[model samples]
Target chain A: MNTSRHTRIRSIAVLIVAALILEVTTAVQYYSTRSSVASVIMEMAQRDVSTINRVAEVKKIAENALHHAVPEVERLFAQGDRDSLYRVLQQIVREHPELVGVDFACKVGDDGKRDGYFTFRNEETGGIQDTIIGFDYTERSWYREGLKHNGFWTEPYMSRYYVILMSTFAYPVRNDKGEVVAILGADVPMHELSAMTVQLYENMNHSLVPVIGLQLLGLLLLGFIMFRSIRSVRRLSEVSAEKDLINKELDIANDIQTAMLPDSSQIHEFAGEVSGTQNVKDCIDIAGSQVPAKQVGGDFYDFFVRDGKLFFNIGDVCGKGIPAALVMSMTQAVFRSVASKENSPARILQDMNVIASQGNSTGMFSTIFVGVLDLATGRLQYSSGGHDRPFVISGGALRQLEFKPGFPIGIMENATYWDFETEIAPGDMVMLYTDGLTEAMNGEKNLFGQQRIVDAINASGAFETPKQLLDTMSQAVAGFVCGAEQSDDLTMLAILYKGNSAADFPQK
Target chain B: MQITKTVENDNLTLSLEGRLDTLTAPQLEAEVNGKLDGVKTLIFDFQNLAYVSSAGLRILFMAQKIMNKQGKMIVRNANADIKDIFTVTGFSNILTLE
Candidate 1:
């Protein structure tokens, strides 16, 4: 897979695994918490059910006592004797420790005197006592409820008689005529509930806490690791993507910059079309080349004949790389525009300066040698814009044609430039170059200089075609600076003026 | 190229070292582009400058233009070889030098 797809899959895989792990943790926690809650609810409901069951148990014991000793209880109650009923309640409480108090409640006279006593487990005495004997228990909830139900169990509540969260299991004591005379009750408190659940929990859910706790710890550790890994993955991908975009843009810029230069085949085409006569391509043979140290360079050479004159310029824009490349194109366009209308080298340079300085915010300039060759006269007039001198080779001799020093274009608006002139005989050549050639550095930091350039031109047949001269010079410079990175944009333009003039070619 | 910058009052001083050619000219231009505001005087200390191309001169022209509208700009302490490039290019006309 490609890197982006691979990275997406990796990230998605990581997320899936983490999500699965998280899902396990969440499911474990959710189910465990749900089970715990269910257990709590069950425990609570079980307590309520057991509470009801215990009330029934107490009623059964009371019923059993009444069934066995009802005759004695009624007789004693009628005789105003309570020792037997007190012994029975004490026995029931001792057997069922959940019960804190038990009593026999009854009515005695026409005024309805509350007589039977409530027996409680006294803390100070550690014995049964009749603490509720004198209290009027008829108006209370337990007595009123006991009278109403007569024999059923009552809901658990705080019994004023027992002074605890208690319930009474009450049943009626009937005389021989089956007339209800008194009620028997047993009070049970819920203070022992906590002890009951502890036993119930050990029997039901023993290993749940530690297992769920360990899963929680694992979840946290895995979550942290996954989060960190994903963060780093995203950061790495972003950086690589940015780098790729920049490299891609540089490649495009390099292609565009290289395409912007003047091509040699164009000259042959221009020569044929402009002259409108056969075999006039020999009148002006021109060739040039540029190589940037970086992928994109600021060196450019442009030439287009206007009205039978070859107007050409070679330039090195300030700076390098993308910024320089942009400036280079702008300078090339400006030169073409100005030279089309104005053929004078000086006027073209001046007009270019005006255009270049208008919104020149980047503070870059082009050092240029703008030259125009008259195909009819074999005369060349050129202007300098802070550019180096060109060398002319004719009649087996070489000489540098120097021009007046001028400001490089884009430095100042309305800067004046002056044109210089020279004549090219048959077999004569002109070599124009940027500083990249002379200032080319070697491994030992020595410049190739003008001497090597002149020597290279002389070594090559100076009378050869323009392309030969350029190739020879470039090869010599590259040979001198072998294995050393070229540190600047190297540009050179070579031209061999030919075929004398229009008169020499005569009419076909 | 190495450039050291110092700002005193409204004057910004830039000290240039090594060759200010195609590769290093932007370094100088970017340094002073932001600091040109509210500065009445801009100074270029070329004491250690050995070589300058038209690229370097272009930066000088920009600074001079910006300073001309705000205050004044000048290049001083230029060595003989560095001065010769300025002299030959007639950069002296567009820029003020000492």
Candidate 2:
């Protein structure tokens, strides 16, 4: 997949995994919390049942005390003794401390002369033999229940003094006729049950504290990991953007460098200035060849008129890309400056050498061939800086115009360039080229070489224009290379000395 | 190309007219090189000048380089096109202009 799609997929996968992990953890926590809460509820219910059981145990003891003591009270009541009944109630109270009070109520006779005695105790004071004991036993609930059944118990209720208690386990003392005559009952309080419920609630709260704490810690760690991953992704994106920006800048620099060279059409237009001259222009026509390189190379050539002289120069910097581009611009500027000031080719190169040497901090250099064609004399005065010698095609035979080589520009401060002069007869051509043309290699590592170049020029025979010569030479180099990659900068310049007038030349 | 020179006490004001191109660049270069011995300041008035090519720019570069050692050079009354070219090429950063 493309990088954008791949990154998106990876990000989505990470998010899904993170979400799934978070979801699973939440689910596990939820289930665990549910179980814990359920257990707490179950424990609370068990505590409630245990409290009820303890209350039941206390009620049983109160029932036994009432059952044993109520009979002796009834026996004393049968003998009409009130003091003995009171003593029996006091004894029951001492045996069952959980009971708050015990009371006895008796049926009233018509004389109202204390014929029957009833005793009741105040739970707070534990005092017995109250005067209100004869207050209509038939109207009391415990009395009516005792009268109806042999024994009965009441639901839990608050005492008259506001204590939480229950009156239960009432016992009836019947005379020989089996009619209920007296009733005995006991009351139990619920303080122990309330204390147990409070303890259960406190335990449930304590168990939940650590569970919430652990969940918070887990969330904190996940947040930290996500933050770090996001930061790293941002840094990578910034670096990628910076690299793309730098590449775009290099492309712009390449365009600016290419703009500095003269176009092929412009070069031909400048060569037109020498056209129609008799012997100077009709030297040879080498035509019908073209090769387009992929990238702009570190080669340059220009021709301009200065001081009634035709000044032309072809040069190649040592490298390619931005460094080479900078050097090429500098060389062009210095050449223009020195050409305008000096008439001799040698003096111009000497001046350029000094300026270039001072400015070239990278130790890079350039090879240049500068020439001035004198229109008045049909003479070419030239100088070379370690550049290739030009080839002269004359009388249908091509040969090299050999000259002494000087050091390349920017290599030494005081380097001297020697001048040479060549006289052009009716038909002679001088072809100048960089090493790229001669050194071009085929797939088998065979070079085009200088001889092949000269042969191509001679074979073109009598040509019409200088462009034809350059084009033919370029084609010969391309054919020799045969699809091999270009490893150096290619440049060429051709000049034909046509002598004085167009009448001396033969028609095509 | 026409260059009108007005010499004051220590400053030289040169008003340039017509086109400052490759053909006329040498005339200006020679004029400045001839008269720039003792002047403390040189002013280039481009009120009537129409165009400046790369050749013209080379002369300006030479003038600036020369002035850096001895005196100061100021360019005034530059038309919009020339000013735009100077800004694009970063010459505005190197020269004093008004």
Candidate 3:
């Protein structure tokens, strides 16, 4: 009976050791598999974020193009300037590859005749085809719905011309009497976006197979160890939950970055209030836009009126995304705080450099252009921190505003900046932009270049307002890029000086 | 980006080919930050380099800061476009270009 008890005890010990070994091996496999799966998911998530950002960017560009073209289209059509309308339509489609076609469907006139045109990219021949509206476009949904709504995004439908799936952004053009005169439709192919979705699905499936196989094997090993398997599943859910939290935080950060910049409407309202109290009406017309390649970018612009001077600045940090965004925010804050007490742009830049250079161990730097415009005399005192020289448009001529390019901020503690003076007439405009404008790359890796910028500005004709000119320039760049992904933030600021005089200004 | 590193005595020469952009800047950053040890002189050959983005500039700036205490760094064979970028960013004043 003692020998029988000894054998039984040994058997129990052996079973315990085997169970321990199985548990340890299963735990190791689960840990490694979890990490690998996490990494795969992380990579896939990153790609999805980037692709979604690009898709959103393309949509925004298309919307802007439609919005900007409305006024021009209305004006041209009112004047019966079909030639200009044709040119505009061709330019829009030629520049933006995403725009498969554009049509200006006019409202049937009192004479039972419709004057409209359609310009489309012929996918088979790889050429743009322009023709007068042939069919009964009055029955088309784009025309009917566009006239009914302020702006509409049409459901995806197969394009009869290109024989591909296309969606359209339809906008109604109004006459001076507030009557809808025509419907403007911009078509975008759905194939590219659909292809991206398909690619993402394929990637998920490729990564999911191994993950599933590993999980199955783990479950088989842990079938006897119920508590541990449950714990592993719980940990995986926690990891995925953390990913969702991270995505939400990133979106919040993007929103905060956008909120930090001054809104154009706020600037205008502030101008109005100042003019109401101080007789500074028509002193300045300012507009600016910042489009980040990613959700958050390192480009910033700010303008505020204080003590009869318009303190405005635009800056670009020497990188992209989060790190650059941090520096951009700091630089903008420093500029705003310094400009509050400082009257000289050079001094503000100097103080900014000193502050930024301190504790800048990461070697991050920013190129900034600061301007303090005197509303009374139209005298502008500007300083540059290795930034692009702004352009002045006066008397229907374009010229670069000359300035000494100083070292970018945060490079050296002792870097000094100099203030240069320039005078803008009663009806002059100044344009400031970052390198993203000139260095925009197309699919062929060719830069949009400074020459293209000059050409676009020159071709944009005489500017009536800052917003119109800014829109024209933006459209030009968008067209030049042809829907390629931008690698940097595109920021632009335009200020039209109307002088302190309330007199009717000279036209450019 | 391809980084060909050659060390002779106390001097180090890294010849670069292709683009130094957002995607490739980290690779070069790792190479520079991880390997600079006991080197008195460092040289960057950019004969085959085609482009350099702001990220590339940041990496170069970091390297310059490190070499300021250890030794000197020189950039060689930069094309006109690269020179234009340096001139605009004021990096020409800070970096030794040849």
Candidate 4:
């Protein structure tokens, strides 16, 4: 059993161990991916710049040919020599299949009229293509764009004259004063541009192989680690489920044990019935409370008015938990049976001792205090069975009541007990409690002694009724043991007396 | 809580150490549940025992009650504080201590 427990612990801890290892490796993988991708992108970017510069140098030669010819063409046109200009245009358009055509338009008059020039190469006949009349060339996108910049690369567009998607490079020719006089450029078909883009992508793909490889490797590693983690997740869940089962059982046991105790509402009902009568309400008031250290404890208390007199008992069994709880229940029943038949506190205790010791097979015992109050005379008859001495508050004095102690019940057979009596004067309060009160401990393990209890009573001002005394004292004990586990069961009872009539507190 | 046992023929001695409260009481209970079936003398060593809540006392009671029928049970090496608890709760009357 112990080995399996250890194995379960190891299985649960394995998840943390594996996760920590994976975390470090994955962190390394993450940084490697970033640096590798960055370097690859840097290399590709440099290659693309080199490729563009080379293509621009080649294309510039052809545009430069048009530029060099511009001055000559201008001189010839001024001389009205259209033939030499045509020769220059024809030489430029001669052999390059991609260079569809070359054109040069110049305004000769202030009316902005342009002398349009030409070249001929049809698509069906695949040499340099033909160009038609330049109609208002200023309105042309290439002309307007080139006028702004010396070298302007036009976007691929369908030319009205060529009737095909084409790209253009237009270079402006400037006079001595730097004013644009003419535009000279060539047309390239879209298919060649598409081809260059495809080649660039192919080169990028080759350089990117390592980056993509690392990414895929990281993904596979993550998948494998995730699978292992998922398997360990079940082990952790199994451990949690076992813990949950234990916790649920504890809650259910606590609930069942609490249900076994009589609810205060039932006690309140009896207490209420006995009150409301002017004489009983004025002459007597009784309250009792109990709190177990565990889900179930061995402390118990009961109070009732019998034969025009009040009788009460509070006891603590030797130990705690289920066994002591069972004995506690038995003690209550035995005390109730014995108390009903007997009026004297000593006789009631003696009777309970005999009955409790009946099956004395289990060596269990309880310290108890029993009391009988004579309502007419305001006298309280009481007995202690190895319990803590009771306390009384009268004439503004708080002290433990003096009494002879006897052996606790269930310890020995035919044990004799003695009863003691004290007067419950008007405004006097009587308090009966178990040792769990005085023996309450704090986090430092220091006991809350009987002197503290006496001080608590004196600290709280006059008790108007028994319940007030009980509540204040309970609160004091609770405050004394704050944040400390209740090491024992605590039970307390208090009785505050008034004179035999409601006349004590005069009605207006 | 740690429980170490030494067995010799009809005698068995268990050395108990640490707190024997509600949480650890069941362990001692399990060790005593018929582990002494054929043993004539069962002994408890409490030299290192720090505390025993009432729940722990219940288990001890059960072990004593069981041994009452078939063998002898005794506890030894209890510190003064533990002895005081036993005396106050009446366990000293029934349990043999040394």
Candidate 5:
């Protein structure tokens, strides 16, 4: 995969891994929190139940003791020993500090005089007290309950001193004839029950501390993981942006290299010569397309007039991309320099060959075709450096210009080039091309060869001007290729020698 | 067609007038290519030039290649329409301009 795609996949993998980790961690935390809370709540409930049970146990014990004392107090009351009753109440209060007080009451005479003296001890004050019990107590609920029932206990109540108290095991004292005469009672306080409930609340608070601490830790870890993942993603994006910027700069450099070569439209203006009449001569029309097998290719073409001679050249360097572009530019500059001093096409090529061989340390060479058209006689002189021969059309017949191959440019310093001359008639056409044209392949890998090119030229009708000939040739090549990618630079230069009397060409 | 050139400190400046196209490109090409020796920089001034066809583009390509080896080539003051053409054909990427 490309670097960017690989980086993207890696980033996504990291995120997914992080997400899965977070999800699993969160689930664990949630379950742990839930179970921990439940355990704490259950423990608190158990403590509450135990506290209630303990309080109940103590109350039961106090009730049993009070009941046991009540029967004894009844017997004492029947014997009419108030002093003994008071001593028994004092002993009970000393045995149980939780009991506040114990009291006894007997009915008074009708004249409101004391008929009986009842004694009790106030446990809260640690004092023994007695009172002549009044008949008015018969209407009280606790007294009435005790009279109706043989023994009874009362609900808890707040006593005069603001203590929570309950009267337990109240017994009715019987007279000598077996009639109920008075009630015996004992009181208990609830201080121990309140203390147990306070202890249960304290235990619940202690158990919650660890559970809350674990939950907070889980949250902090999740936040940290999320932050780290985001930072990594941001860093990856910045790296991708930097790579893209570098690629753009390389692309710009490549473009500058391509712009240096001769474009097709200007071939006619620069390729040939002008006559004494100041009329343009030897107009060459270049119609070619390029499809790089890679990012860039080495095909190039150039034209210029120097010292009254039209200098035109087509070359294909042996490499591609920036290197080939650089070499092609160098070749053009060398050709221009040599063309200025040399009037003969052969001498110019020889000079260029020497210069190129010296400069080309890479062992690279270029196939070149250099031609000079004489505007005076419509005579074209040409020399080739291991390049394709020209296809000439004359008298409605196609023929290849015969020549021996010379060494490609930059191969040898003293390589000799021979000049060959051809006379171009008014309607005659000369076509110079690179291998890209003949080697162009279709979907079936079939090449558009030289014969096909000749056939296309023969098929095109006679044109009034050189430009028309070029246009027809270009259309024919396009038709032959038919949507096929140009595998290399397809370069073609067609020169038509117009007679002196031909009508001026139409301007675009 | 007329092509005027001035050289100073290894920099060659060509001010183009009339049309730079298939019919007129030879005059400019000949004048520029003949004096390319010792030139380190080339600046094409298209301010007074009225038109350039594909033929003119080819000559400019040749000129740029020549300059690429020696120094740099710059095209200046291109009209809006020509600039649009350059951009569409991907020539804008290839040429150095100001």
Candidate 6:
């Protein structure tokens, strides 16, 4: 009972812990997921806004530099000064570091063909370098498109002079005749903006790595708890199943133990209401009671009337449980077989001791009180083998019978028991019990001693029937124990002598 | 349960204190299990011993049986309560008490 309760408590605790862990893990996961998504979105938005602002700032700087150089180059071209135009282009490239190059394309001989001089910074030497746009310069899209559109930003292309990706801001130039003559342009490198965007995406990926790893760890922990809980539940069921099987076996054993004794139903009837009106001649009222602390116990009592004599015995093995129970049953069988042929309780005990003591390596022993009551004479012959001396109640007074002590059976091979005789009158009772009665303990650890036994018999009324007498003793012990757990098997046997006068019974 | 052992020559004395019920009988059993070789006398001193149950009696019986084969065993200083138990159980016949 206690073990199952403890298991229940432990199971509840485990479930609560599991539930708590699950709740914590789910809450952490939900909040982490939400916050991580929000962070990623916020990072992307910031990156987009910053990238646009950077590009716009660079565009404004390039536009300012280009507008500043357009007029100088146009004035130099109108003068037809090639050196001054070249110097002006080189100065534009040097003045604004964001501009990769500067160029001027002229339409010559009215054929709408174009040639231009491009000046660019040499990145490694930090020097200005010039290249002539002499080969099919009119076929270039920037040159053709620049002539048609003013202040146009051209598609990005590879700069042959600077060997880098570049985009041009083209401004058309005209002479004092207000006719288009040439196109002036400023070029900017495109790699800077693209590299910044790549860096932003790389940082976002780095930030998500820890979050993904933490989610995996949480999942592993949950799996481990699930496995442990499953295993414990399986083990708990197995234990309960095993307990049930043991209990079933004990029930069967208890049945066998009870069956081994004489049928108590007849004894109960003899000691029941019939005692007040039925025949009292040559008849004895006897009853036995046994209560084992466990499902099966080591205490026993038996009685059978044979050849006009009542042969009876009560015994308790040294220990409780199965080992003691095995000895108890064996002893009972020995008593029955020996008493069937012998009339002397001493000899029966002697033969039993001899048989029990042989090869008793485990040192197990039992205390027994054997008796023979002659129904005709009311003479009782009894023997004690390390057993408690019985109490005889006569004339409203209870007295303990005395006998010489002998070692408990199975302890010494040569131990001898002596017979003690006592005469019983009509309306007298004899009580026999094991030490489990006197040694029974209460919650305070105090024993229900021999004095209490006498008092209980007295208080129960000396002339009560054997069954009522045994019941009174049982109630007394139970009351004294006060619901404390029984520590040993308690047994009691009562035999009431009703006298043997033929005139008292009338043969009914 | 506490057991104090004193061995001098062939005489071995074990002083036991506290209760020797079912739970602590095995401790005394382990101490005397197979260590009695060459001993001519065994003495159990129970001056401080408090209580004993049937399980404890079984252990004492085992020790007495062993010593009976080779030597004599003596139990000494049992209190009134323990002596009553010994007398009632008839252990007084098999065991020599002082």
Q: Compare the candidates by DockQ and give the number of the best one.
A: 6
- Kindly report which residue stretches of model 1 are placed more than 4 angstroms away from their true locations once superposed: A1-231, A238-246, A273-278, A459-463, A505-508, B5-12, B36-41
How do all the candidates rank in terms of DockQ, highest first?
6, 1, 3, 4, 5, 2
Interface root-mean-square deviation (Å) of every model: 1.7, 14.6, 1.5, 4.3, 14.9, 1.6
Evaluated at residue A167, the lDDT of candidate 3 is 75
Superior by DockQ: candidate 2 or candidate 4? 4
- Model 2's DockQ? 0.01
Ranking by lDDT: 3, 6, 1, 4, 2, 5
Question: Given candidate 4, what's the lDDT at residue A94?
Answer: 76
DockQ of candidate 4?
0.13
Docking class of 6: acceptable
In the range A129-181, model 5's lDDT, one tens digit per residue, is 65555445555555668778877777766554435544455667677677777
Chain A TM-score compared with the true chain A, each model in order = 0.55, 0.49, 0.53, 0.56, 0.51, 0.61
Number of clashing pairs per prediction, in order:
0, 14, 0, 3, 5, 0
- Per-model DockQ against the true two-chain complex: 0.44, 0.01, 0.42, 0.13, 0.01, 0.47
* lDDT by residue for model 6 (A8-110), tens: 7887788789778878877787788778778877887887788678767777887888788778777878898889889888888888898888877776546
- Point to the candidate with the largest TM-score: 6
Q: What C-alpha lDDT values do all the predictions have?
A: 0.76, 0.69, 0.83, 0.74, 0.67, 0.82
Q: In model 3, where do residues sit more than 4 Å from their true spots?
A: A1-237, A272-281, A503-508
Whole-structure CA lDDT of model 2: 0.69
**lDDT of the structure predicted as candidate 3:** 0.83
Q: Which residue window of length 10 is worst by lDDT in model 1 chain A?
A: A499-508
On a 0 to 1 DockQ scale, where is model 6? 0.47
TM-score of each: 0.59, 0.42, 0.60, 0.56, 0.45, 0.66
Candidate 3 lDDT, A1-508, residue by residue in tens: 3443554455555557657867776776677678867876787688779767876776777788888888888899889898998888888888888788898888887887887789988878879889888888887788879989999888888887777787788899888899998888998787886787788777767766766776677667557556554654565566667667876887798899889888766655555534443444468888898899887898999998886778999988988888998999899889989999999999999999999999998878888999998887788999998888888989778898787678889988998788999888989999999878877888888887777877987887888889898899889988888999998899999988987664432221
Per-residue lDDT for B24-58 in model 2, tens only? 77798888765688888989999998655434655
Which tens-of-lDDT digit does each residue in B1-98 have in candidate 4?
A: 99999998899999999867656887988998767789889999999997765557767877887888989999999987677667645567678999
